[model samples]
Target: MTASLSYAHGTSATPLLGETIGDNLRRTVEAHGDREALVVRSQGYRATWRELWQATTDVARGLIASGVKRGDRVGVWSPNRHEWVVLQYAAARAGAILVNINPAYRTTELDYALRKCGVGVLFLARGFRQANYVAMLAEVRPNLPDLRLALTFEDDWAALLDAGRGVDEAVLAERERSLQFDDPVNIQYTSGTTGFPKGATLSHHNILNNGYFTGEALGYGPDDRVCIPVPFYHCFGMVLGNLACTTHGATMVIPGEAFDPIAVLETVQAERCTSLYGVPTMFIAELDHPRFAEFDVSSLRTGIMAGSPCPVEIMRRVISQMHMREVTIVYGMTETSPGSTQSARTDSIERRVSTVGRVEPHVEVKVVDPATGAVVPRGTSGELCTRGYSVMLGYWDDEAATKAAIDAAGWMHTGDLATMDAESYVNIVGRIKDTIIRGGENISPREVEEFLHTHPAVSEAQVIGVPSEKYGEEVMAWIRVRAGATVTPEELTSFCAGKIATYKIPRHWKLVDEFPMTVTGKVQKYRMRELSTAELGLGKAAQIKMA
Candidate 1:
């Protein structure tokens, strides 16, 4: 397992780092002054370069008036709205660390993030889907002693806007001041799988550089109109959607609420959107929508799918039905500013469908043997490692954990198991920690999950290893059947028998109505393990069962 290096097909001398996202946005606004900058169609809100700058400044001034200072943490808990983008730029201009809070977070989750970040101010929506954000904040206010202001999108916005009056001139002057590119710009908490969330400290250079490289990889330009259905709280939206659009002076069309397949199609058609970015689930929903064929989606030129493995069928439909010219699959964790490798647009269809594409420009990726810490050769599966300008500064207030994930040589060890092909395309096999060993044979849970997804009755599936007496572990699966469909353990076992090895087939199955998921929509397999062990009453034996 010796590590080797392979450079990207094209290389350039351009620096991969930048001063600040705000600086880059200001330059774009100056160059494309009258151009449309952002469109929040649901709210009937649109901002050109000039109007966006003014609004950003107003928010910055309001922040200052509310006692925010450089390096202070400002938390935003809202859906994908125009104000969310305004808050991002305003915090950058004010030198405050923007902390994105998932709108779906419960009271306990919100309290934990707010206290962990020591957030001084919070911006929230009044209510969405029965979660009254303002009420939740009020409930947690007593516990969060550092919080000084609670501004709402519905109630307190006007007052906050009025507060921006006297400080307008000062805000403009402050925006002109030089900012350190390496300074921490935001803290994005990882979607915790095993334990509590950990904040990944991303610097201005980390995020801005990632945006630049992503935009260049997609060949984005001033006239490009990108549709963003992903939530703004995630790194995919912040870097790939917002920062990339700003860097290229591209128009960003945002849908402010939960994703609806019909709405997404309409937005693309009406806006003439050239690009779209979403998770695999989003694409699946769009493709499965009954009226999918009714819309004219020929305007869609390119798209980026990530967060989970996408089905090959979905990719095919994107090209054939939606007339997509390029569909790239991106892979990375929050610690890498969420952009490590992407499938190139020019790659062959087989390569694009089989892998997660090549490493982006100025980024280094390596596959290392998990047990020995040695780099694995090409075409071998190992833990993926990445090093680049986009690597996070560290976990906020968690030195030991940060040191464990990021090495002294600057490579961030992603806990994903993957193999690099001869052409440098990385194919994700499974998570290093999620791999199941059954009867002395290794099984990839992702492989089983993908196979299960192809089943007509299955809507979603999760596999985990549980304890066994004869074998070290046995395969166990929990599946969510599609509406009006029925599936049994024996039938699924029969289906997998010839398609995969007998040992990889699940010996036990649980048909679940819904899966416990994290805020970001990731299935919580660790929780499933606990539930299965408790219900089976097999004690330690149940813990070793593999799925």
Candidate 2:
């Protein structure tokens, strides 16, 4: 472990799971059948591990009876509902690739995701927030030739389970036995810088092992009660939240469909949750809540805080006030089953807040020179690359992207600049890519810029991330209008109102004739970010030091 070369690998004797997700669930149910497995406090629902398996079996058989063949894609577009968890396992049990759609997606985004994966059966909520999912689905259903049926949670939930009553138990057993651990089971749509999202296809081996190791790092057990408020659509929730709990036979507790600080506090106090999960912003909201002190969260021992930098002050408060003495920070992209490096429960406050901890078990991480693609010396900032079992199979149907990201030698070059310390602790400095992560949501600047170009008056558009106190970063758009065409900020806002997610909408708009360019005539996004920060009087926010 000298500081000469930047490379490390986790070696463990514990064997990785070699069975399908359904088999893993069966093993856990056999051991912890009567134990409380899931609790949706918001919906007033609770179920044991055995009950959950029965429900999951019903849905799996129903999917099979509905002409859902193995290897087909089943999409679920909703928030943190109890059924979302069931669908996670049911799809795996039925041999369908479960595609996780962002709940905040509007018509344009949803249409693209549903068509991209050729989702056969879509399960969705009727309405959430401002978007009427039913109406949006109707608008796009005609275009989706592969979409066979769309079922609503409230209307078709019972019917779906009942449809499985006639399915023979031997049918499901045969399907389960025919599956392998290497089969693709989940498709998570992650925003790319190329104006569209890419579906990262993951196998049972990739996600199941990552979840087990992450939970093992935190020492999760059957007695642990985890309160997860993160959305079920992302790896943070689907892999780390639910899979982590199920792998260890822990209880999965949902606070609300969407993030509500009060709901989280109340759920923790009422459920006596032992662990919690969220990004740093979420922890900040809970810690700063007016009635935060009134809740009894003494049951908490450990949890995960990730997706953004963990500030020193915020981490300290979370450890002290939230009773999470062992709160850890994880680092990885959606391509790595969502976790590659994680801090241990015994890490010091300095290491926990400053670094993303050491590499996880059965994975390898290294710092490499981006230009040369050669491993760099430790303590030197370079692009972080990971290679191991947790890497995704590839981007769905995009061979070029798959090759571009994961190299010929099997290394996923994470386009993130980082440095590995002498102790193998990693610290992320900046990203080489153009994706903007605001409030734990990855927003592609190209996607938003393309949407803005749809406006008739918009001649050209550029998007960048600016500093913010709350969300760590906020989206700002610079528009160059077409000649003889009139456009106002109000008009632009009105045009993008229901087309994109609220977070993707620009928080700051500037009408400009030309952008800052390099001598080679390329747009200098770094210069734009600097100028916007100065003009918007956000310099103070930008200077808020990080760990």
Candidate 3:
């Protein structure tokens, strides 16, 4: 009757794990003591389970010696590096809340995060790309009186480690004993479309179990070496990449301080990596690299392509050329420790390419009508919501925002519009806010963007609704053309002629060098919309709609 609005719960005999991040790390180290735990190619760093444990404990002791007590907020602002990994585990071991600061953040955003979370200690690289951390810290340090210490990855960080040697081992051990599974241990700021970012406070149990299950889905083990090019600041890296590896005793390989296509390819070939992780764009860069064929990626058996929907062609190429037959698509936000649904290694290629697979083990997912909050029927588009242990405790220190996000019934309302099949595989349509209403017809930008990606000359496409006079809103696309290839708007729209619905096709097109992206590689559509509207003189269109 009524097709019974979509809802699915993961069924499994494997019960949820009940241990803190520190405890789980110790367990995994004992199980795979001789196995490689970390490898940072840029820094030429390598560590086995024993060595990594000792190094992590040293950092933990250093933090304690520096006056970091349990539950203190410690901010880490750096690109992917060996020190970042050490601090991640060290903070958890020392019973401190690790606040991930985006390496892309400037002084203003950095100051807001530090003050919002009351961060007492900050760990940052001396310099990343062109942004000088020292300068930014100098700008904000005056306002951040709570910040007692600032350690750069340069010489200052060396002194921090040395400070640990003087502290008695019992202090570190006592801090470890005080940690609980449910105590908040991590704070990741959700990159909001408007206003300041809200910190998603997560506990050890939230991320640890999510990571273990994600790794299990990818068939990870002690022998699997995972090459991670994603930033450690995002849940995609810290939880999905690092936590997944540590829980399963797999090796975490860092290609560079930041994602480098050549570095990723070279690392995969040199290390004979078994697993890899990236967003779709990262994969595209690696696949399109001039020297792509030179690398030996045959060792790759599985990996993850997420952060956004994977285009069909890209997914096919990754499977055929990259040898990632078991590449999975994960879907979730930082609020849920990153993954609520994932494609499995056993999933068919069709299933892997089309859906985000079934609900993750021990999680419940449902699609509901946005207007009424009632569950929507199968194959019907609606807001996707999740409920499980993986959900964060709440946005840190923001009760009003937390209440608005999580309902009284405990569902974390993911603003994504989605549909479910009879088999329970979920298909993300687009964000609810990304919907475009043109002449009273609703259009999903994701649907049109996917269609445009099929064009041979289009390297990447991002669609957003810009203002219009004839219609309430019109579809506009910013496209990145293939290198040395050219395309005109007329020719491209003509290519879409019969394949897609007329209204869904983008009306205005702009060829661009690159799309504005977050540190985690998510395209900022709102910024694109703003820029397009101004350049196209659509100010009148905005007033027309609002009025």
Among the numbered candidates, top lDDT falls to: 3
Task: Report every candidate's CA lDDT.
Answer: 0.82, 0.87, 0.92
What TM-scores do the predictions have? 0.93, 0.82, 0.98
Compare candidates 1 and 3 on lDDT and give the better one: 3
Q: What digit string (tens of lDDT, one per residue) describes model 2 on residues 218-290?
A: 8999999999998888888889989999999999999989878999999999999999998765786687677
Cα deviation at 106, candidate 1, in Å, is 1.7
Summarize candidate 3's per-residue lDDT along 1-547 as a digit string, tens digits. 2446699999889888898898999999899998899999999999999999999998998999999999999999999999999999999999999999999999999999999999999998898999999999998899998999998888687798899999898988888887789999999999998899999999999999999999989989988999999999999999999999999999999999888899999999999999989999899899988899999999999999999888888999999999999899999999999899999888998898889999999999999888889998899999999999989999999999999999999999999999999989999988888888888888888789889998999988889999888898999989998887899999998998889989988899999988988878888898898889899988844632211
* CA displacement after TM-score superposition, residue 171 of candidate 3 (Å): 2.1
- Residue 424, model 3: lDDT of 91
Stretches > 4 Å off in candidate 1: 1-11, 168-171, 454-460, 480-488, 511-514, 535-547
Error of 3 at 81 (Å): 0.6
Candidate 2 vs candidate 3: the lDDT winner is 3
User: Which 10 consecutive residues of model 3 have the lowest summed lDDT?
Assistant: 538-547
